[model samples]
Target: MTAHQNGTIATEVSHFLLNCFVRSPSWQLWLSLPLSLLFLLAMGANATLLVTIWLEASLHQPMYYLLSLLSLLDMVLCLTVIPKVLAIFWFDLRAISFSACFLQMFIMNCFFAMESCTFMVMAYDRYVAICHPLRYPSIITDQFVTKAAIFILARNVLFTLPIPILSSRLHYCGRNVIENCICANMSVSRLSYDDITINRLYQFALSWTLLGSDLILIFASYTLILRAMLRLKAEGAVAKALSTCGSHFILILFFSTVLLVFIFTLLVKKKVSPDVPVLLNVLHHVIPAALNPIVYGVRTQEIKQGIQRWLKKGW
Candidate 1:
Protein backbone atom coordinates (compact mmCIF):
# COMPACT_ATOMS: atom_id res chain seq x y z
CA MET A 1 0.00 0.00 0.00
CA THR A 2 1.13 3.55 -0.77
CA ALA A 3 1.37 6.22 1.95
CA HIS A 4 -1.92 7.70 0.73
CA GLN A 5 -3.67 4.38 0.90
CA ASN A 6 -2.26 3.66 4.36
CA GLY A 7 -3.33 7.10 5.54
CA THR A 8 -6.82 6.53 4.18
CA ILE A 9 -7.11 3.20 5.98
CA ALA A 10 -5.85 4.80 9.18
CA THR A 11 -8.42 7.55 8.86
CA GLU A 12 -11.15 5.01 8.35
CA VAL A 13 -10.10 3.15 11.49
CA SER A 14 -8.78 5.99 13.63
CA HIS A 15 -10.35 5.44 17.02
CA PHE A 16 -12.74 3.07 18.78
CA LEU A 17 -15.23 4.08 21.46
CA LEU A 18 -15.87 1.51 24.19
CA ASN A 19 -19.34 0.92 25.59
CA CYS A 20 -20.18 0.58 29.28
CA PHE A 21 -23.09 -0.53 31.46
CA VAL A 22 -23.91 2.81 33.00
CA ARG A 23 -25.51 4.83 30.24
CA SER A 24 -26.73 7.37 32.78
CA PRO A 25 -24.19 10.02 33.72
CA SER A 26 -25.10 9.92 37.41
CA TRP A 27 -24.23 6.23 37.98
CA GLN A 28 -20.56 6.32 36.92
CA LEU A 29 -19.43 7.63 40.28
CA TRP A 30 -21.08 4.76 42.11
CA LEU A 31 -19.74 2.25 39.61
CA SER A 32 -16.20 3.62 39.92
CA LEU A 33 -16.05 2.84 43.66
CA PRO A 34 -16.39 -0.93 43.32
CA LEU A 35 -14.30 -1.19 40.16
CA SER A 36 -11.48 0.73 41.78
CA LEU A 37 -11.69 -1.50 44.86
CA LEU A 38 -11.47 -4.65 42.79
CA PHE A 39 -8.49 -3.34 40.87
CA LEU A 40 -6.69 -2.40 44.05
CA LEU A 41 -7.44 -5.74 45.67
CA ALA A 42 -6.23 -7.66 42.67
CA MET A 43 -3.00 -5.69 42.48
CA GLY A 44 -2.36 -5.61 46.22
CA ALA A 45 -2.96 -9.33 46.69
CA ASN A 46 -0.81 -10.39 43.75
CA ALA A 47 1.98 -7.96 44.61
CA THR A 48 2.17 -9.20 48.17
CA LEU A 49 2.36 -12.77 46.97
CA LEU A 50 5.11 -11.96 44.51
CA VAL A 51 7.11 -9.99 47.07
CA THR A 52 6.81 -12.75 49.65
CA ILE A 53 7.98 -15.33 47.18
CA TRP A 54 10.88 -13.12 46.18
CA LEU A 55 12.17 -12.47 49.69
CA GLU A 56 11.83 -15.93 51.17
CA ALA A 57 14.63 -18.36 50.31
CA SER A 58 12.44 -21.29 51.26
CA LEU A 59 10.00 -20.38 48.44
CA HIS A 60 12.73 -20.84 45.80
CA GLN A 61 11.29 -24.08 44.52
CA PRO A 62 9.40 -25.29 41.47
CA MET A 63 5.92 -24.98 42.96
CA TYR A 64 6.46 -21.49 44.37
CA TYR A 65 8.09 -20.49 41.10
CA LEU A 66 4.91 -21.48 39.29
CA LEU A 67 2.84 -19.55 41.86
CA SER A 68 4.98 -16.46 41.29
CA LEU A 69 4.45 -16.80 37.56
CA LEU A 70 0.70 -17.00 38.18
CA SER A 71 0.90 -13.85 40.30
CA LEU A 72 2.80 -12.07 37.53
CA LEU A 73 0.28 -13.08 34.88
CA ASP A 74 -2.62 -11.96 37.09
CA MET A 75 -0.95 -8.61 37.69
CA VAL A 76 -0.47 -8.08 33.98
CA LEU A 77 -4.03 -9.17 33.24
CA CYS A 78 -5.47 -6.75 35.80
CA LEU A 79 -3.30 -3.92 34.53
CA THR A 80 -4.25 -4.63 30.92
CA VAL A 81 -8.04 -4.53 31.43
CA ILE A 82 -9.02 -2.59 34.54
CA PRO A 83 -7.43 0.86 34.36
CA LYS A 84 -8.91 1.53 30.96
CA VAL A 85 -12.25 0.27 32.22
CA LEU A 86 -12.04 2.59 35.21
CA ALA A 87 -11.04 5.42 32.86
CA ILE A 88 -14.09 4.74 30.75
CA PHE A 89 -16.34 4.63 33.78
CA TRP A 90 -14.93 7.68 35.53
CA PHE A 91 -13.62 10.16 32.95
CA ASP A 92 -15.46 8.85 29.91
CA LEU A 93 -12.13 8.26 28.21
CA ARG A 94 -13.63 5.85 25.72
CA ALA A 95 -11.84 6.77 22.51
CA ILE A 96 -8.87 4.45 21.98
CA SER A 97 -6.54 4.82 19.04
CA PHE A 98 -6.56 1.95 16.51
CA SER A 99 -3.00 0.90 17.35
CA ALA A 100 -3.65 1.03 21.11
CA CYS A 101 -6.77 -1.09 20.75
CA PHE A 102 -4.95 -3.85 18.92
CA LEU A 103 -2.10 -3.76 21.44
CA GLN A 104 -4.57 -4.11 24.29
CA MET A 105 -6.28 -6.96 22.50
CA PHE A 106 -2.95 -8.72 22.02
CA ILE A 107 -1.91 -8.43 25.68
CA MET A 108 -5.32 -9.54 26.93
CA ASN A 109 -5.41 -12.61 24.69
CA CYS A 110 -1.79 -13.62 25.33
CA PHE A 111 -1.94 -13.24 29.11
CA PHE A 112 -5.25 -15.04 29.57
CA ALA A 113 -3.96 -18.07 27.68
CA MET A 114 -0.72 -17.90 29.66
CA GLU A 115 -2.68 -17.78 32.92
CA SER A 116 -4.64 -20.89 31.96
CA CYS A 117 -1.41 -22.66 31.14
CA THR A 118 0.01 -21.63 34.51
CA PHE A 119 -2.96 -23.23 36.21
CA MET A 120 -2.41 -26.39 34.22
CA VAL A 121 1.24 -26.47 35.18
CA MET A 122 0.35 -25.91 38.83
CA ALA A 123 -2.06 -28.82 38.62
CA TYR A 124 0.73 -30.98 37.23
CA ASP A 125 2.94 -29.91 40.12
CA ARG A 126 0.27 -31.01 42.56
CA TYR A 127 -0.26 -34.24 40.64
CA VAL A 128 3.37 -35.23 40.77
CA ALA A 129 3.64 -34.18 44.38
CA ILE A 130 0.67 -36.33 45.32
CA CYS A 131 0.55 -39.23 42.87
CA HIS A 132 4.27 -39.89 42.87
CA PRO A 133 5.54 -38.33 46.05
CA LEU A 134 8.81 -40.24 46.11
CA ARG A 135 9.86 -39.06 42.68
CA TYR A 136 8.55 -35.46 42.90
CA PRO A 137 12.02 -34.03 43.52
CA SER A 138 13.27 -35.57 40.30
CA ILE A 139 10.11 -34.92 38.31
CA ILE A 140 9.21 -31.35 39.36
CA THR A 141 12.60 -29.67 39.37
CA ASP A 142 13.76 -26.11 38.75
CA GLN A 143 14.61 -27.11 35.20
CA PHE A 144 11.08 -28.44 34.77
CA VAL A 145 9.58 -25.16 35.97
CA THR A 146 11.84 -23.21 33.64
CA LYS A 147 10.74 -25.34 30.69
CA ALA A 148 7.08 -24.98 31.63
CA ALA A 149 7.42 -21.20 31.86
CA ILE A 150 9.04 -21.03 28.47
CA PHE A 151 6.38 -23.30 26.99
CA ILE A 152 3.54 -21.23 28.46
CA LEU A 153 5.04 -17.99 27.18
CA ALA A 154 5.96 -19.23 23.70
CA ARG A 155 2.87 -21.33 23.02
CA ASN A 156 0.35 -18.68 23.97
CA VAL A 157 2.23 -15.77 22.40
CA LEU A 158 2.73 -17.50 19.05
CA PHE A 159 -0.83 -18.78 18.83
CA THR A 160 -2.55 -15.57 19.95
CA LEU A 161 -0.34 -13.17 17.98
CA PRO A 162 -2.35 -13.62 14.81
CA ILE A 163 -5.64 -12.59 16.40
CA PRO A 164 -4.92 -8.88 16.70
CA ILE A 165 -2.84 -8.83 13.53
CA LEU A 166 -5.76 -10.22 11.54
CA SER A 167 -8.23 -7.94 13.31
CA SER A 168 -6.13 -4.86 12.57
CA ARG A 169 -5.78 -5.61 8.87
CA LEU A 170 -9.54 -5.44 8.23
CA HIS A 171 -11.01 -2.32 6.66
CA TYR A 172 -13.12 -0.31 9.07
CA CYS A 173 -14.79 2.38 6.90
CA GLY A 174 -15.75 4.61 9.88
CA ARG A 175 -17.83 2.36 12.16
CA ASN A 176 -15.29 2.02 14.98
CA VAL A 177 -17.38 1.62 18.10
CA ILE A 178 -16.51 -1.50 20.13
CA GLU A 179 -19.52 -2.73 22.07
CA ASN A 180 -17.63 -4.13 24.98
CA CYS A 181 -15.30 -3.20 27.85
CA ILE A 182 -12.02 -4.70 26.59
CA CYS A 183 -10.89 -5.27 23.03
CA ALA A 184 -12.39 -8.73 22.80
CA ASN A 185 -11.72 -10.53 19.50
CA MET A 186 -15.29 -10.85 18.24
CA SER A 187 -16.37 -7.49 19.57
CA VAL A 188 -13.54 -5.70 17.75
CA SER A 189 -13.62 -7.86 14.63
CA ARG A 190 -17.34 -7.25 14.08
CA LEU A 191 -16.68 -3.52 13.69
CA SER A 192 -14.87 -4.07 10.39
CA TYR A 193 -16.44 -3.67 6.96
CA ASP A 194 -14.88 -6.94 5.82
CA ASP A 195 -16.28 -10.41 6.45
CA ILE A 196 -14.88 -11.84 9.69
CA THR A 197 -15.62 -15.51 9.22
CA ILE A 198 -12.00 -16.51 9.42
CA ASN A 199 -11.44 -14.32 12.46
CA ARG A 200 -14.40 -15.88 14.21
CA LEU A 201 -13.37 -19.39 13.27
CA TYR A 202 -9.79 -18.82 14.41
CA GLN A 203 -10.95 -17.42 17.74
CA PHE A 204 -13.24 -20.39 18.33
CA ALA A 205 -10.51 -22.85 17.49
CA LEU A 206 -7.92 -21.01 19.60
CA SER A 207 -10.16 -20.83 22.65
CA TRP A 208 -10.99 -24.52 22.56
CA THR A 209 -7.53 -25.67 21.59
CA LEU A 210 -5.72 -23.88 24.43
CA LEU A 211 -8.33 -23.79 27.19
CA GLY A 212 -9.93 -27.14 26.40
CA SER A 213 -6.63 -28.98 26.48
CA ASP A 214 -5.63 -27.28 29.73
CA LEU A 215 -8.96 -28.11 31.37
CA ILE A 216 -8.73 -31.75 30.31
CA LEU A 217 -5.17 -32.12 31.59
CA ILE A 218 -6.07 -30.30 34.81
CA PHE A 219 -9.04 -32.60 35.33
CA ALA A 220 -6.96 -35.68 34.66
CA SER A 221 -4.23 -34.53 37.07
CA TYR A 222 -6.75 -33.93 39.82
CA THR A 223 -8.46 -37.25 39.15
CA LEU A 224 -5.22 -39.13 39.62
CA ILE A 225 -4.55 -37.04 42.72
CA LEU A 226 -7.92 -37.97 44.22
CA ARG A 227 -7.42 -41.64 43.48
CA ALA A 228 -4.02 -41.57 45.12
CA MET A 229 -5.44 -39.77 48.17
CA LEU A 230 -8.21 -42.38 48.45
CA ARG A 231 -5.65 -45.15 48.78
CA LEU A 232 -3.91 -43.65 51.82
CA LYS A 233 -4.02 -45.84 54.93
CA ALA A 234 -4.52 -43.02 57.42
CA GLU A 235 -7.59 -40.78 57.35
CA GLY A 236 -5.40 -37.81 58.28
CA ALA A 237 -3.23 -38.51 55.28
CA VAL A 238 -6.28 -38.33 53.00
CA ALA A 239 -7.43 -35.09 54.60
CA LYS A 240 -3.98 -33.52 54.30
CA ALA A 241 -3.64 -34.53 50.68
CA LEU A 242 -7.02 -33.07 49.78
CA SER A 243 -6.24 -29.86 51.64
CA THR A 244 -3.01 -29.37 49.71
CA CYS A 245 -4.69 -29.14 46.31
CA GLY A 246 -8.21 -28.06 47.26
CA SER A 247 -7.52 -24.31 46.99
CA HIS A 248 -5.84 -24.56 43.56
CA PHE A 249 -8.65 -26.80 42.28
CA ILE A 250 -11.27 -24.30 43.46
CA LEU A 251 -9.46 -21.37 41.84
CA ILE A 252 -9.06 -23.27 38.56
CA LEU A 253 -12.73 -24.30 38.61
CA PHE A 254 -13.86 -20.71 39.15
CA PHE A 255 -11.47 -19.31 36.55
CA SER A 256 -12.39 -21.81 33.83
CA THR A 257 -16.12 -21.77 34.64
CA VAL A 258 -16.44 -17.96 34.43
CA LEU A 259 -14.46 -17.83 31.18
CA LEU A 260 -16.49 -20.66 29.65
CA VAL A 261 -19.70 -18.87 30.67
CA PHE A 262 -18.41 -15.67 29.09
CA ILE A 263 -17.68 -17.54 25.85
CA PHE A 264 -21.17 -19.08 25.86
CA THR A 265 -22.67 -15.67 26.48
CA LEU A 266 -20.76 -14.47 23.44
CA LEU A 267 -22.46 -17.17 21.33
CA VAL A 268 -25.93 -16.35 22.69
CA LYS A 269 -25.43 -12.60 22.42
CA LYS A 270 -28.90 -12.20 20.94
CA LYS A 271 -30.52 -13.46 24.12
CA VAL A 272 -28.38 -11.71 26.73
CA SER A 273 -27.48 -8.10 27.31
CA PRO A 274 -23.98 -7.18 26.11
CA ASP A 275 -23.36 -5.90 29.61
CA VAL A 276 -23.56 -9.48 30.92
CA PRO A 277 -20.47 -10.65 29.07
CA VAL A 278 -18.75 -7.34 29.65
CA LEU A 279 -19.19 -7.63 33.38
CA LEU A 280 -18.17 -11.27 33.26
CA ASN A 281 -15.03 -10.36 31.37
CA VAL A 282 -14.21 -7.67 33.91
CA LEU A 283 -14.79 -10.01 36.84
CA HIS A 284 -13.01 -12.81 35.04
CA HIS A 285 -9.79 -10.82 35.21
CA VAL A 286 -9.98 -9.52 38.75
CA ILE A 287 -11.75 -12.22 40.77
CA PRO A 288 -9.32 -15.09 40.31
CA ALA A 289 -6.34 -12.74 40.54
CA ALA A 290 -7.52 -11.49 43.92
CA LEU A 291 -8.52 -14.92 45.20
CA ASN A 292 -5.68 -17.14 43.96
CA PRO A 293 -2.99 -15.89 46.32
CA ILE A 294 -5.38 -15.70 49.27
CA VAL A 295 -6.65 -19.24 48.78
CA TYR A 296 -3.15 -20.65 48.40
CA GLY A 297 -1.75 -18.64 51.30
CA VAL A 298 -4.47 -19.85 53.63
CA ARG A 299 -4.65 -23.45 52.47
CA THR A 300 -1.18 -24.41 51.31
CA GLN A 301 1.00 -24.97 54.37
CA GLU A 302 4.26 -23.78 52.84
CA ILE A 303 2.77 -20.57 51.47
CA LYS A 304 0.92 -19.99 54.74
CA GLN A 305 4.10 -20.43 56.73
CA GLY A 306 6.06 -18.30 54.29
CA ILE A 307 3.60 -15.46 54.71
CA GLN A 308 3.79 -15.78 58.47
CA ARG A 309 7.59 -15.68 58.41
CA TRP A 310 7.57 -12.71 56.08
CA LEU A 311 5.11 -10.88 58.32
CA LYS A 312 7.26 -11.56 61.37
CA LYS A 313 10.10 -9.81 59.58
CA GLY A 314 7.81 -6.77 59.07
CA TRP A 315 5.86 -5.96 55.87
Candidate 2:
Protein backbone atom coordinates (compact mmCIF):
# COMPACT_ATOMS: atom_id res chain seq x y z
CA MET A 1 0.00 0.00 0.00
CA THR A 2 1.17 3.53 -0.84
CA ALA A 3 1.68 6.16 1.81
CA HIS A 4 -1.31 8.10 0.55
CA GLN A 5 -3.45 5.03 0.96
CA ASN A 6 -2.09 4.32 4.46
CA GLY A 7 -3.98 7.30 6.05
CA THR A 8 -0.87 8.65 7.82
CA ILE A 9 2.11 10.55 6.44
CA ALA A 10 5.15 8.33 6.17
CA THR A 11 7.83 10.90 6.81
CA GLU A 12 10.68 8.43 6.45
CA VAL A 13 10.44 6.69 3.13
CA SER A 14 13.06 3.99 3.00
CA HIS A 15 13.51 3.92 -0.76
CA PHE A 16 12.50 5.52 -4.03
CA LEU A 17 10.80 3.58 -6.77
CA LEU A 18 12.14 4.83 -10.07
CA ASN A 19 9.34 4.88 -12.61
CA CYS A 20 11.30 4.93 -15.79
CA PHE A 21 8.81 5.32 -18.61
CA VAL A 22 6.04 4.15 -16.36
CA ARG A 23 3.53 5.67 -18.69
CA SER A 24 4.72 3.56 -21.58
CA PRO A 25 6.12 0.11 -20.84
CA SER A 26 6.62 -0.27 -24.55
CA TRP A 27 9.30 2.38 -24.49
CA GLN A 28 11.35 0.38 -21.99
CA LEU A 29 11.27 -2.66 -24.24
CA TRP A 30 12.34 -0.53 -27.19
CA LEU A 31 15.11 1.29 -25.30
CA SER A 32 16.59 -1.74 -23.51
CA LEU A 33 18.65 -3.12 -26.37
CA PRO A 34 19.99 0.20 -27.61
CA LEU A 35 20.91 1.42 -24.13
CA SER A 36 22.72 -1.83 -23.30
CA LEU A 37 24.67 -1.67 -26.53
CA LEU A 38 25.61 1.97 -25.93
CA PHE A 39 26.71 1.18 -22.39
CA LEU A 40 28.98 -1.63 -23.54
CA LEU A 41 30.35 0.46 -26.37
CA ALA A 42 31.08 3.37 -24.04
CA MET A 43 32.85 1.13 -21.56
CA GLY A 44 34.93 -0.69 -24.16
CA ALA A 45 35.89 2.42 -26.07
CA ASN A 46 36.85 4.45 -23.01
CA ALA A 47 38.80 1.52 -21.57
CA THR A 48 40.70 1.20 -24.86
CA LEU A 49 41.44 4.92 -24.92
CA LEU A 50 42.70 4.91 -21.33
CA VAL A 51 44.86 1.82 -21.83
CA THR A 52 46.34 3.14 -25.06
CA ILE A 53 47.28 6.40 -23.39
CA TRP A 54 48.75 4.56 -20.40
CA LEU A 55 50.90 2.14 -22.45
CA GLU A 56 51.99 4.56 -25.14
CA ALA A 57 54.95 6.54 -23.81
CA SER A 58 54.61 9.02 -26.65
CA LEU A 59 51.24 10.23 -25.28
CA HIS A 60 52.71 11.71 -22.12
CA GLN A 61 51.60 15.29 -22.64
CA PRO A 62 49.18 17.74 -21.10
CA MET A 63 46.67 17.40 -23.94
CA TYR A 64 46.63 13.62 -23.82
CA TYR A 65 46.39 13.73 -20.03
CA LEU A 66 43.29 15.87 -20.30
CA LEU A 67 41.88 13.49 -22.92
CA SER A 68 42.40 10.59 -20.54
CA LEU A 69 40.66 12.57 -17.83
CA LEU A 70 37.72 13.07 -20.17
CA SER A 71 37.57 9.37 -20.86
CA LEU A 72 37.68 8.65 -17.16
CA LEU A 73 34.85 11.07 -16.50
CA ASP A 74 32.82 9.46 -19.28
CA MET A 75 33.39 6.03 -17.86
CA VAL A 76 32.44 7.16 -14.36
CA LEU A 77 29.27 8.78 -15.61
CA CYS A 78 28.27 5.67 -17.54
CA LEU A 79 28.93 3.47 -14.57
CA THR A 80 27.05 5.69 -12.15
CA VAL A 81 23.76 5.83 -14.03
CA ILE A 82 23.54 3.08 -16.64
CA PRO A 83 23.73 -0.13 -14.62
CA LYS A 84 20.71 0.75 -12.50
CA VAL A 85 18.82 1.90 -15.57
CA LEU A 86 19.54 -1.37 -17.35
CA ALA A 87 18.42 -3.24 -14.26
CA ILE A 88 15.15 -1.40 -14.33
CA PHE A 89 14.73 -2.11 -18.01
CA TRP A 90 15.49 -5.81 -17.90
CA PHE A 91 14.56 -7.08 -14.46
CA ASP A 92 12.19 -4.42 -13.09
CA LEU A 93 14.54 -3.51 -10.27
CA ARG A 94 13.75 0.09 -9.38
CA ALA A 95 13.99 0.28 -5.62
CA ILE A 96 16.84 2.72 -5.00
CA SER A 97 17.54 3.33 -1.33
CA PHE A 98 17.33 6.90 -0.06
CA SER A 99 21.05 7.10 0.59
CA ALA A 100 21.94 5.50 -2.72
CA CYS A 101 19.71 7.94 -4.57
CA PHE A 102 21.39 10.90 -2.95
CA LEU A 103 24.78 9.43 -3.66
CA GLN A 104 23.92 9.06 -7.31
CA MET A 105 22.65 12.63 -7.38
CA PHE A 106 25.87 13.94 -5.90
CA ILE A 107 28.08 12.06 -8.36
CA MET A 108 25.97 13.12 -11.33
CA ASN A 109 26.11 16.79 -10.44
CA CYS A 110 29.77 16.80 -9.41
CA PHE A 111 31.13 14.82 -12.35
CA PHE A 112 29.14 16.83 -14.90
CA ALA A 113 30.61 20.02 -13.53
CA MET A 114 34.04 18.44 -13.56
CA GLU A 115 33.57 17.47 -17.20
CA SER A 116 32.67 21.04 -18.08
CA CYS A 117 35.75 22.29 -16.28
CA THR A 118 37.85 19.75 -18.17
CA PHE A 119 36.49 21.04 -21.47
CA MET A 120 37.29 24.59 -20.46
CA VAL A 121 40.84 23.59 -19.60
CA MET A 122 41.12 21.76 -22.90
CA ALA A 123 40.01 24.86 -24.74
CA TYR A 124 42.70 26.82 -22.97
CA ASP A 125 45.21 24.16 -23.94
CA ARG A 126 44.22 24.56 -27.56
CA TYR A 127 44.39 28.33 -27.28
CA VAL A 128 47.86 28.18 -25.85
CA ALA A 129 49.06 25.74 -28.49
CA ILE A 130 47.58 27.74 -31.34
CA CYS A 131 47.79 31.37 -30.18
CA HIS A 132 51.06 31.20 -28.27
CA PRO A 133 52.86 28.24 -29.79
CA LEU A 134 56.20 29.14 -28.28
CA ARG A 135 54.82 29.33 -24.75
CA TYR A 136 52.71 26.17 -24.94
CA PRO A 137 55.43 23.95 -23.52
CA SER A 138 56.08 26.10 -20.46
CA ILE A 139 52.43 26.99 -19.84
CA ILE A 140 50.88 23.51 -20.32
CA THR A 141 53.36 21.30 -18.53
CA ASP A 142 52.67 18.07 -16.61
CA GLN A 143 52.65 20.05 -13.39
CA PHE A 144 50.16 22.44 -14.93
CA VAL A 145 47.86 19.57 -15.85
CA THR A 146 48.12 18.25 -12.30
CA LYS A 147 47.20 21.64 -10.91
CA ALA A 148 44.29 21.95 -13.33
CA ALA A 149 42.99 18.52 -12.30
CA ILE A 150 43.14 19.53 -8.67
CA PHE A 151 41.29 22.74 -9.36
CA ILE A 152 38.62 20.92 -11.34
CA LEU A 153 38.00 18.52 -8.46
CA ALA A 154 38.03 21.19 -5.72
CA ARG A 155 35.92 23.73 -7.55
CA ASN A 156 33.23 21.33 -8.68
CA VAL A 157 32.99 19.59 -5.33
CA LEU A 158 32.70 22.86 -3.45
CA PHE A 159 29.96 24.03 -5.77
CA THR A 160 27.98 20.80 -6.22
CA LEU A 161 28.17 19.23 -2.77
CA PRO A 162 25.36 21.44 -1.55
CA ILE A 163 22.86 20.22 -4.13
CA PRO A 164 22.41 16.70 -2.85
CA ILE A 165 22.91 17.76 0.73
CA LEU A 166 20.15 20.32 0.43
CA SER A 167 17.85 17.88 -1.29
CA SER A 168 18.44 15.13 1.21
CA ARG A 169 17.51 17.37 4.13
CA LEU A 170 14.05 17.95 2.77
CA HIS A 171 11.06 16.25 4.47
CA TYR A 172 9.78 13.54 2.22
CA CYS A 173 6.36 13.03 3.80
CA GLY A 174 4.93 10.36 1.52
CA ARG A 175 6.02 10.24 -2.10
CA ASN A 176 9.06 8.10 -2.92
CA VAL A 177 8.54 7.53 -6.60
CA ILE A 178 11.08 9.20 -8.86
CA GLU A 179 9.80 9.71 -12.38
CA ASN A 180 13.20 9.44 -14.06
CA CYS A 181 15.73 6.66 -14.51
CA ILE A 182 18.44 8.25 -12.40
CA CYS A 183 18.03 10.31 -9.29
CA ALA A 184 18.10 13.71 -10.95
CA ASN A 185 18.27 16.55 -8.45
CA MET A 186 14.99 18.26 -9.16
CA SER A 187 13.19 15.02 -9.79
CA VAL A 188 14.12 13.67 -6.42
CA SER A 189 13.63 16.94 -4.61
CA ARG A 190 10.20 17.46 -6.08
CA LEU A 191 8.99 14.32 -4.35
CA SER A 192 9.28 16.02 -1.01
CA TYR A 193 6.33 17.93 0.40
CA ASP A 194 8.49 20.73 1.71
CA ASP A 195 9.11 23.90 -0.26
CA ILE A 196 12.02 23.40 -2.66
CA THR A 197 12.61 27.10 -3.19
CA ILE A 198 16.09 27.06 -1.76
CA ASN A 199 16.99 23.93 -3.70
CA ARG A 200 15.79 25.42 -6.97
CA LEU A 201 17.44 28.74 -6.33
CA TYR A 202 20.78 27.22 -5.44
CA GLN A 203 20.74 24.87 -8.42
CA PHE A 204 19.89 27.71 -10.80
CA ALA A 205 22.58 29.92 -9.34
CA LEU A 206 25.22 27.18 -9.45
CA SER A 207 24.34 26.12 -12.97
CA TRP A 208 24.64 29.64 -14.27
CA THR A 209 27.66 30.62 -12.21
CA LEU A 210 29.66 27.43 -12.78
CA LEU A 211 28.62 26.13 -16.21
CA GLY A 212 27.94 29.60 -17.57
CA SER A 213 31.39 30.78 -16.66
CA ASP A 214 32.97 27.67 -18.20
CA LEU A 215 31.02 28.21 -21.42
CA ILE A 216 32.05 31.87 -21.65
CA LEU A 217 35.71 31.03 -21.07
CA ILE A 218 35.61 28.17 -23.56
CA PHE A 219 34.08 30.47 -26.15
CA ALA A 220 36.70 33.14 -25.52
CA SER A 221 39.53 30.64 -25.83
CA TYR A 222 38.16 29.27 -29.08
CA THR A 223 37.57 32.75 -30.46
CA LEU A 224 41.21 33.60 -29.87
CA ILE A 225 42.21 30.28 -31.39
CA LEU A 226 40.18 31.01 -34.54
CA ARG A 227 41.71 34.47 -34.89
CA ALA A 228 45.19 33.04 -34.52
CA MET A 229 44.52 30.39 -37.15
CA LEU A 230 43.15 33.05 -39.52
CA ARG A 231 46.30 35.15 -39.34
CA LEU A 232 48.64 32.25 -40.16
CA LYS A 233 50.28 32.98 -43.49
CA ALA A 234 52.05 29.61 -43.80
CA GLU A 235 50.60 27.42 -46.54
CA GLY A 236 49.57 24.55 -44.24
CA ALA A 237 49.38 26.38 -40.90
CA VAL A 238 45.58 26.77 -40.88
CA ALA A 239 44.97 23.20 -41.95
CA LYS A 240 47.42 21.87 -39.41
CA ALA A 241 45.79 23.89 -36.65
CA LEU A 242 42.36 22.67 -37.66
CA SER A 243 43.56 19.10 -37.67
CA THR A 244 44.97 19.54 -34.21
CA CYS A 245 41.75 20.96 -32.71
CA GLY A 246 39.11 19.20 -34.80
CA SER A 247 38.54 16.31 -32.38
CA HIS A 248 38.29 18.49 -29.30
CA PHE A 249 36.05 20.94 -31.06
CA ILE A 250 33.67 18.26 -32.30
CA LEU A 251 33.48 16.59 -28.89
CA ILE A 252 32.77 19.82 -27.03
CA LEU A 253 30.19 20.87 -29.60
CA PHE A 254 28.25 17.66 -29.12
CA PHE A 255 28.60 17.85 -25.36
CA SER A 256 27.38 21.41 -25.12
CA THR A 257 24.67 20.97 -27.71
CA VAL A 258 23.11 17.93 -26.07
CA LEU A 259 23.31 19.58 -22.66
CA LEU A 260 21.56 22.69 -23.93
CA VAL A 261 18.85 20.58 -25.51
CA PHE A 262 18.30 18.69 -22.29
CA ILE A 263 18.03 21.93 -20.38
CA PHE A 264 15.64 23.34 -22.93
CA THR A 265 13.42 20.31 -22.90
CA LEU A 266 13.42 20.41 -19.13
CA LEU A 267 12.41 24.04 -19.05
CA VAL A 268 9.59 23.41 -21.49
CA LYS A 269 8.46 20.18 -19.96
CA LYS A 270 4.84 21.27 -19.96
CA LYS A 271 4.90 21.52 -23.73
CA VAL A 272 6.70 18.24 -24.37
CA SER A 273 6.27 14.64 -23.50
CA PRO A 274 7.45 13.87 -19.96
CA ASP A 275 9.63 11.07 -21.21
CA VAL A 276 11.52 13.33 -23.58
CA PRO A 277 13.63 14.93 -20.88
CA VAL A 278 14.23 11.62 -19.15
CA LEU A 279 15.33 10.00 -22.39
CA LEU A 280 17.56 12.96 -23.17
CA ASN A 281 19.01 12.79 -19.69
CA VAL A 282 19.82 9.10 -20.14
CA LEU A 283 21.30 9.67 -23.58
CA HIS A 284 23.28 12.62 -22.32
CA HIS A 285 25.04 10.27 -19.94
CA VAL A 286 25.95 7.57 -22.47
CA ILE A 287 26.11 9.00 -25.98
CA PRO A 288 29.02 11.38 -25.41
CA ALA A 289 30.92 8.59 -23.68
CA ALA A 290 30.38 6.22 -26.57
CA LEU A 291 31.37 8.88 -29.08
CA ASN A 292 34.42 10.37 -27.35
CA PRO A 293 36.96 7.63 -28.07
CA ILE A 294 35.57 6.93 -31.50
CA VAL A 295 35.73 10.59 -32.47
CA TYR A 296 39.30 10.90 -31.22
CA GLY A 297 40.38 7.68 -32.90
CA VAL A 298 39.01 8.92 -36.20
CA ARG A 299 40.28 12.51 -36.03
CA THR A 300 43.50 12.42 -34.02
CA GLN A 301 46.33 10.74 -35.89
CA GLU A 302 48.52 10.20 -32.84
CA ILE A 303 45.80 8.40 -30.92
CA LYS A 304 44.91 6.34 -33.97
CA GLN A 305 48.51 5.24 -34.34
CA GLY A 306 48.71 4.49 -30.63
CA ILE A 307 45.66 2.27 -30.83
CA GLN A 308 47.14 0.48 -33.84
CA ARG A 309 50.40 -0.13 -32.03
CA TRP A 310 48.55 -1.41 -28.97
CA LEU A 311 46.46 -3.78 -31.09
CA LYS A 312 49.52 -5.13 -32.90
CA LYS A 313 51.29 -5.72 -29.60
CA GLY A 314 48.21 -7.46 -28.18
CA TRP A 315 47.92 -9.72 -31.20
What are the lDDT scores of the predictions, listed in order? 0.87, 0.93
lDDT tens digits by residue: candidate 1, 92-162:
89999888899999999999999999999999999988888899999999999999999999999999999
Indicate the worst ten consecutive residues by lDDT in candidate 1: 1-10
Q: Over the full model, what C-alpha lDDT does candidate 2 score relative to the true structure?
A: 0.93
What local lDDT score does residue 292 receive in model 2, on the 0 to 100 scale? 89
TM-score of each: 0.93, 0.97
lDDT of 2 at 112: 95
Q: Top model by lDDT, which number?
A: 2
TM match of model 2 to true structure: 0.97
lDDT tens per residue, model 2, 44-97: 999999999999999988999999999999999999999999999999999999
